[model samples]
Target: MLDQKFATLPKLILQIVQMLQNQSPSDSLNEIIRLVARKFVGLGVLEVADELEIQEAILRLEKEIIDLEATINSASDIKLAYAHNSKLEASGKIVFTGQGAYMCQVSAGGDVLAEKKDSIFRGGRLIVTGNAVLNELGSPMATPTMVEFVFGRRILVNRVYPGVSFRVGRQLFKVQEGLQDVRVAVDEQGILRVDYLYKEHLQ
Candidate 1:
């Protein structure tokens, strides 16, 4: 039964078992003493104590599997976050246009030394192209230029409820999730409309 349980254990646990199995015979014997105490609970009569100990070991192994699963999930989330930040493929350039804006161009390059009015570029995001120099603030309602971050990086604003925000505009947007739907919009209200609709889709 122990052998079967060991075989079904998670890969990490299996590696641990193999490590123990390869230990010196003296080491294995000493460790087995503890295993017996914890895993042999089910044996009846004269061996009842040994059986109960084995049962306890089996319980521990099960718990280890559960713990391993949780760890894997956490690793997955971290990996996803990293993918969103670095190693992300930049698709195309999004140009920002506003009143008195012209000949402004933004590219997929993380770093582009471009100038525009009311626009600020940072962290190698969307390229802004049009008339006039890019200013940090184009319109309060819309991002003059921005990138769609695949993974939303959270910032703690309020310690109580874990208030978080992402970077946006000239500054960080401080969104709970990453940015979404980054496009250049024409007209005043149109930019705001684009941001609102795109943000919803991102969620």
Candidate 2:
């Protein structure tokens, strides 16, 4: 017996292929994102306690089509630092309390960070001068979230939505599938890599 969840994926792919043949990549991306958002339900992109949360996230994702390579700048509501490493002392830290953060952008610098649960950074972008550690980004739903750094080279996150884009210097990484607890960084070779780091340093 075929599983009900995967039933529409093949059809979706066929539609995408046809769209590609008839339209430019940019022209078809919006539709493709929409189809993916609708089809990805129960596909296990996130591990949440309630089904409602998943639906809410998906609904939010459907609002914005992800742009993988476009330069992103989120309208910010919070500013933690100015990227000079002077505002925060070595012992300083940044914290996001209950409900994490939603619908607004956060800009920070350096390595001091921690967040509570229910974090879904949708509809905004994050600008950090250094490393950015986030509990969640984007959503299983498919909205694209951007994290930009002019001087930093790393971003660590526990949960990733499919369209989360990271820009570190000239390197760019766009997550096309859901991921958990990974590191995104530019290596010594100046190449960007997404992988797991068993131990992390927090300041």
Candidate 3:
């Protein structure tokens, strides 16, 4: 069980800080440790008197977060720019208006906009705080693109192709087929589920 949790620790760390900007990196790291403890307990790993093993495990997780700190800190709390058009990689409140298909891997501190009608995110994601306006998300195949919004709990799409999924607060929604001018949200309940969103999801 300890090994299982250790193996999943890296993935958990990635999700914890993915697009989660505007906060101090140190604070985020601290939060990661706390979350790790809770995850262990939830996963049926009881509290052990062998605190050394846990400390070592947490130290390893800290190094993982440190490596990710550059990418996390690259984004600003406010609107930021995309580094390259080819990769379509950007973060921090971006407005992208492009054409054709591309691996649009975006991370934002707040909102994101895919302005043009031809802007397509073939196999990527739009992770943000509030809303994200996109022309297209996901491919006709594969695992589909992901749109994760927590604050506004809304995602507007001009043309949402098949194979798209969303993670709004603690709730999860997926688009198996296509749709046009779509608006996805978790309703009013998203804000009230503070336990799952903050404590559980963050856990």
Candidate 4:
């Protein structure tokens, strides 16, 4: 029954071919010829639609790959550093409290030596140095063992004293002394900076 329905396809194609030979080149004629060719080759319109969808999907995948590569390259260009055998020293005014606690903020002064990006400095130690005074009223003993330097929420140095250096990571420092008012001030334009001197490993 289906064969009988399509038995006139050949006759129909012949009519279209004859019509095209007599007609001038036009969009409608071209469309009719394309449809007839597809039908004769047993290629349905649904198959052509599926092929177009597949091509579009491939294009989208290629675009996504390009975007991903760009993101990875951007991430690689970002600068990051870890604590190594480096020393950060700073001198600033220390505000001493009556309870023997001291607070100070030291700016990097744009001369932050640790800002240098060297491959050898990765995963190295970090030592911090600065002027510290022990409050004699708080500890009753002027010893390095009575002083403590707190970095942010962590205890950086439990035992320290004036002119003694300690190790610290990337964090702010708050000194705890006996009851001494140790003040180190800088010029109005001068920034209380930390000088980071890398270890000899980088040499």
Candidate 5:
């Protein structure tokens, strides 16, 4: 009976508790301690005295596991935030547009505009065009003269008529008669700066 109880106790605590179902409650604690001492020969009779300490250690380990899981979740959230910031930093395109604003298609230097499909401008000589126009009595009077932008150097166009212009550094030079504005160089630091041209009409 002692060997059987010791074997059952080593298998599972639930098995030991089931085995004690037939025993009186008053003798169950002593029987459990004997079985535990027999299973762990080095612990001897001290198993009964150390039961509360063992339970405390188990509780501590469970709390530590829960804390470790929470820490892992926090690290995952930080990684996700970093990834989102990286995506935002990599994106180099106009996100918002007003009533009379336009973001033109981007192409590589010396590439044909007809082949350009992606609108996100990155660097090098980029062709920017306006799609906003003013109509007078069902007739298109004039399109947007200048395109105010924010990137790299401060570029300002005085009178931007229908023409293709090239921007080198902070200077804007007319190139051809078309609907494209070209940016010559890319910013080195990747820090975005504003370049705006405001024209006020006085009556």
Candidate 6:
């Protein structure tokens, strides 16, 4: 019975061959021929499907590989260092804070530096030279929020909102809308100067 059913396959093949011969040269015509050949000649359906599935799997895997590479490139390294190191003893302002109980690691650029754990923090200030990031050693529950605090000489101003008034020290300053440029500076005394840290230091 199966043989009889398949006996007409030759006729079908002949029809397909004729169709291929008369077909116009187009992208779709080539795909139709491939489909007809695979279906009519008892061609390996499993192999064809497997090849397609493998191709799809390979594409997905390649996408995943690319995503992983991007993540690695953007990831930060956690290293351990001392707060009293000469490298951090320059003249800059600390812009972050962490819970003192846990070991703190500073993330500068892409490298991580582990610093000693301290509980008693006199103030949330790390005066050093250049732009650097400092954090608690452990994976803390929250990202360190940059708050306006008195370090030594320099003043840090964050949370700049448009159409709002800011209270720094004892005076209040009103901010105007559509302000494109902002300048911060420090004077001989503890005052907010007009300047900006446009670029980061290369460390």
RMSD of each: 16.3, 22.0, 17.2, 23.6, 20.5, 20.4
Greater-lDDT candidate between 1 and 4: 1
Per-residue alpha-carbon lDDT of candidate 1 for residues 1-203, written as tens digits (9 for 90 to 100):
55554343344345445544533334443454456444442442235345445455556655544544554343111101111123232232233333212222223322222223423332333332222122332222333333332222211111100112223343444333333323223333322112322332221
**Which segments of model 5 are wrong by more than 4 Å?**
1-48, 76-203
lDDT of each: 0.32, 0.56, 0.60, 0.31, 0.31, 0.33
Clashes of each: 51, 0, 0, 8, 0, 17
lDDT of 5 by residue, 1-203 (tens): 33333343444544334544644333534544555456345655345354554454334434434544454344111111011112221112222122211223332111111111222222122333221111110001233222223334333222223333444336454423322232233357753332224322322
* Model 5 RMSD vs true structure: 20.5
TM-score of 5: 0.20
**Roughly what TM-score does model 6 have, to 2 decimal places?**
0.24
Candidate 6 worst ten-residue window by lDDT: 136-145
- Top candidate (lDDT): 3
TM-score of each: 0.28, 0.47, 0.48, 0.20, 0.20, 0.24
Give the least accurate 10-residue stretch of model 5, judged by summed lDDT. 76-85
lDDT of 6: 0.33
TM-score of 1: 0.28
Candidate 4 is scored at a TM of 0.20
Please provide, for model 6 over 1-203, each residue's C-alpha lDDT reduced to its tens digit, 9 standing for 90 to 100: 43353354445445445444534434543554455456434643334444444344334434434544454445333322223212322122222223332222222332121133332112222222222222321122222222122223232232222332323355444433312223433356756443433422212
lDDT measured at residue 51 in model 1 versus the true structure, 0 to 100: 44
Q: Which whole-number lDDT from 0 to 100 does residue 158 have in model 3?
A: 68
The TM-score leader among the candidates is 3
